[model samples]
Structure formats: structure tokens, C-alpha cells
Target chain A: QKEVEQDPGPLSVPEGAIVSLNCTYSNSAFQYFMWYRQYSRKGPELLMYTYSSGNKEDGRFTAQVDKSSKYISLFIRDSQPSDSATYLCASAANRGSTLGRLYFGRGTQLTVWP
Target chain B: NAGVTQTPKFRILKIGQSMTLQCTQDMNHNYMYWYRQDPGMGLKLIYYSVGAGITDKGEVPNGYNVSRSTTEDFPLRLELAAPSQTSVYFCASSYSMTLKSANEKLFFGSGTQLSVL
Candidate 1:
């Protein structure tokens, strides 16, 4: 099985709606969790990052990590059209090949309609 | 800082042709990585270097090679291009004070779109 799994969603939502993106992983060694935003033809940009399990808030985005369940999520409040993009969840194990290379999810494509 | 920069934003090659995807970072980060993103798939690591002259493979490394001769650059080379190798390539770099540091905040390049026909 893949180390990380996420629902590849083309989830469509109207402006001002709440959006939630999630991912689950099987690697217990993963110690760092992150969320990235990728627009078409662009590389994935780091959106949020957290260590261990907890919630980190930045602006309209919130990242939650549950080490016990190996699950992570990104929540966007009052979403806007400018927020439309693919959201990717990634994790890193301290002692892995590639020196902290992130294991990424398939990504959840979100569309915030105006 | 230009964080990370990749050359040849787009390229097309015939089968068995060879090419190199160049990556450079001004951050002077010790950790640099090369990844490929295929349609409907998550990014797969091709190669990574933690420091100059120290390179290693990631999840997907076949048909590809990499070199880290300097702290600022890590280049990925395809010896014999194949159609299956066509994908968007990304170069990323991160700084960790120690070798075992758990931090993995990555800064990526714009990307290089390559088509192997």
C-alpha cells in the first residue's frame, strides 16, 4: 500500500463555503505533516506545516494532525475563488531515505466558485 | 531569494534521446530533491542529495540519475528517454540544522514539463 492516501477530489463549492481536505497514512514513522497548494502548471507550494499531532491555524486555513490515527486534514473557512487549486497532504519520516523527502498524497482538487 | 530555480521549463524529446533537468537553489540548503508528477498521481521522488557528493534514490529512481557536485545545484539526467518518463518534474530544497532534524518544509521550483515522445 502507498504510504499516504488521499481522496482525489474535484470537489466543487460555492464561494463563502467551508472546505475540508484530508489524508490518511500508514507510516507510523512519519513525524512531520504538511499541506501544499498546487495550481495548474505550477509546483506544489507549502501551505501549512505541523509537527507531531495538533492543530495549527494560519489566516483562513487550519491544519490538523492526529498521529494516533495517522490522519491529517486542512480546513478552509470562507473559501474564495482564488483558493481554487489542488490541495496535497504530505508527511516526512525523520529516518528515511532522501533525508526528509516528503511522501505526498494524490491531492484533492478543490474549486471555489464565485 | 529565488528559493529554487529549474531550467528548461518545457522540453520535448524523441525516444532514446538524452537530456538533463537542471535545478539550483540560492538558499544554500543542504537538502535538495528531484521529483516527477505524472497525471492523476502524486509526486514521486526520483533522487535526492543531503549534501554535496552524497546522493540517493527515492521511491521511483529507475531510468534516472542525479548528481550533487555543489551545494546549490542538483541535476537529474535521463540516459535514454522513454515515453513513460514524460511528466512534470519539480526540484525542491530545504534546510535542516542537523542531519536528523524532523523539519521538512520544502521550497519548490516552478517546474519543468518534459514530453518524451
Candidate 2:
């Protein structure tokens, strides 16, 4: 199985709508979860990061992780056109062999229209 | 800070040709990585280096090689390119003060689009 799995969604939404992106991982060693945003023809940039289970919020974006279920999610509230980009979820283990390696899932493409 | 810069923004090569993708970072980060992004394949790590003269393979390392001769540059070379190797390549760097900071964020380069035909 893939270490990380995400729906490659070309999800379209109107401005001010709420956007939710999710991912699941099969690696039990993964302890750190992250969300990255990539614009067309650009590299991915870290948008949100969480250490373990629970939620972390920053402005209009929220990241939630559930270690028990091996699930992670990113929520964007009152989305705007500027928020239109591909969202990628990544996971990393903090232990011996897999220390700095991050596994990423297929990104979901989002378009927020005016 | 020119965080990370990749050269040859776009390139096309016939199968069996060779090329090098250049990446430079001004951040002086100790960790550098090369990844390839394909449609619906996310980003797969090709190679990574922790410091100058030290390199290691990541998930997808075949057909690619990398060198870290300085703290600022990490270059990836494809000696015999194949059609299956065509993809957008990205270079990233990060700094971690300690092992506990393994989750330190990564700074990425714009990208290099390469086509092998």
C-alpha cells in the first residue's frame, strides 16, 4: 500500500466557501503531518504542520490529525481566489531510519472562483 | 534570500541523452533534497544530502544521481535519460537545529520541467 493516499480532486468552490482536504497514511511510524500548497508550475510550500494527533489552527486554515485512524485533514474557511492551488499532505517519522524522509500523497487541485 | 533556485527551467531531450539539473540555495541549510513530481504521482524523492560530500538515495533513486559539493549547491544528473523519467523536478532545503526538530519546514525551488522523448 502507498504510504500516503489522497484524492486527486479538482474540487471547485465559490468564494467564501469552506474547503476541506484530507489524506490517509498506512505507515504507523509517521508521527508528523504537514500540508503544502503548490501553485501551477511551482514547488510545494509548507502551509500547515502538526506534530501528532489533534488540531492546529492558523488564521483561516486548520490542520487536524488522527493518529488512531491514520488520517489528516486541512480546513480552509472563507476561501478566496488566492487560495486556489494544489494541496498536498505529507507525513514523516521521527525515529531512527526514517528521520528526515517525508512521504507525500497525490495532491488535490482546488479552484476558488469569485 | 533566493531561498532555493533551480536552473534550466525547461528542457527537452531525446531518449538516451544526458543532462544535469542544477539547484542552489542561499539559506546555507544543511539538508538538501531532490524530488520529481508527476501528475497524480505526488512528489517522489530521488536523492538527498545531509551535508557536503554526503549523499543518500530516497524512494525513487534509480536513473538519477546527485552530488553535494558545497553547502549551497546540490545537482542531480541523469546519465541515460528515459521517457519514463520526464517530470517536473524540485529541489528543497531545510535546517534543523536538533533531532527533535525533525519536523522543520522545507524551502523549495520554483521547479524544472523536463521532457524526455
Candidate 3:
């Protein structure tokens, strides 16, 4: 199994609708979770970040991590057309006092239609 | 703060040709990384450095080499360009990865698109 697995979604949702993007990981040691948004021809930009199990909110985006289930999610409230982009989920483990390398999922393509 | 800057936004190279993708960060970050993104895939790490004079390989380091003589620069060199080496490369940096700011501190460069013919 891949360390991280995210659906390669072309999930189209109408504006103002709630959108949920998710990823599952095989490693239980992953302690830090992140969501990045990538526009066409641009680099991935950090959107939401959370540590271990819990929820974090920033404007229209919400990041959730469930350590026991080894799952993570990014929810968009009142989605908009501007939100169309590829969403990548990344995670890293803390090994002793050092941080391990980050592992990324292929990414889910989201299209918020107007 | 130009955060991170990478040169040669686009390039086309002949097979077996050698080149280096330049990257520099003004953030004074102690950690720097090189990653490549292929079509319809996630960014795969090539190499990373925790500090100057220290480097390590990530998931995909073959065909690529890197050096960190200073905190601001970490360049990736392709000794023999191959068709399989064609991809968009990105440079990123961060102060440190602590539990509270583990994933929050990273900053990325726009990227360099390279094509191997």
C-alpha cells in the first residue's frame, strides 16, 4: 500500500456547496498533515496544516486528521470557482528529535463550478 | 522577501546533456529541499539538506545531485539528462519542522520546467 492515498478527483461541485477532499495513509507514525493547492503551471501553495488528530479552520478551509483511522480530510465551505485546482495531501513523521521526509499523495483535482 | 527564487523557468535539453537548476532562498531557512513533479502526479522529493555541508537523498535521487555550501542555495544537477528526467522541478525551504509548525513553515519557489529531447 502507498504511504499516502488520495483520490485523483475531478470532483465538480457548484459554487457555495460544501466540498470534501480526503486522503488515507498506511503509516500510523505520520504526525503532521498538510493540504496544498496547486494552480495551473504554479507551485503547490500551503492551504491548511494540522498536527496529529484534530481539526483546524482557516477562512473557508478546514483540515481534519484522524490518527486512529489513519485518515485526513480538507473541507471547503461555500466553495467557489476560484477554488478550482489540484489538492495535494502531505504527511510527515517525527523520528526522535528530527523530522522525517514528507510523503505526498498524487493529489485530487477539484473544480468548483459557478 | 522573495522567499524562494529559482532560475531558468523553462529549458529544453538534448539527451545526455548536463545542466543545473539554480535555487536560492532569502528566508535564511536551515532546511532546503528539491522536488520534481511529473504529469498527473505528486511532487517526488529528490534531495534535501538540513544545513550547509549536510545533504541526504529522498525518494528519487538517482540521476540527480545536489549541494548545500550555504543556507540560501541548494542546487540540483543533472549529470546526464534522460527522457525520463523531464519534469517540473521545485525548490522549497523552511525554518524548521516542529510539532506546532511542522507543515506550516514551508515556502516554495515557482518552479523550473525542463524538457528532455
Candidate number of the best lDDT: 2
lDDT of 1 by residue, A18-88 (tens): 99999999999887788889998888887988878899999999999999889999999999999999999
User: Model 1 segments beyond 4 Å from truth?
Assistant: A96-99, B97-104
* Candidate 2 error regions (>4 Å): A96-99, B97-103
Q: Candidate 2 or 3, higher DockQ?
A: 2
**Per-model TM-score on C-alpha atoms:** 0.92, 0.96, 0.94
lDDT of 2 by residue, B1-117 (tens): 678999999999999999999999998798888999987888999998889999999989999999989999999999999999999999998885223442567889999999999
For each candidate, report its DockQ versus the true two-chain complex: 0.50, 0.58, 0.55
Model 3 residue runs over 4 Å out of place are A96-100, B102-104
- Which pairs of residues clash in candidate 1, taking residues 3 or more apart in a chain or in different chains? none
lDDT of 2 by residue, A1-114 (tens): 999999999899999999999999999988888899999888899898888789999999999999999999999999999999999999888775343478899999999999
Residue range A4-103, candidate 3, lDDT tens digits? 9989978999999999999999998888899989887777888888888999999999999999899999999999999999999998887632333788
What would the per-residue lDDT of candidate 3 be over residues B1-117, giving only the tens digit for each residue? 688999999999999999999999998889888999998788898988889999998889999999999999999999999999999999988777454674545688999999999
- Candidate 1 chain A, poorest ten consecutive residues by summed lDDT: A93-102
In candidate 2, how many Å is residue A87 off? 0.4
lDDT winner between 1 and 2, please give it. Answer: 2
lDDT of each: 0.88, 0.90, 0.88
Which window of ten consecutive residues has the lowest lDDT sum in model 3 chain B?
B97-106
Model 2 has a DockQ score of 0.58
Candidate 3: the clashing residue pairs are none
Q: Give one clash count per candidate, in the order shown.
A: 0, 0, 0
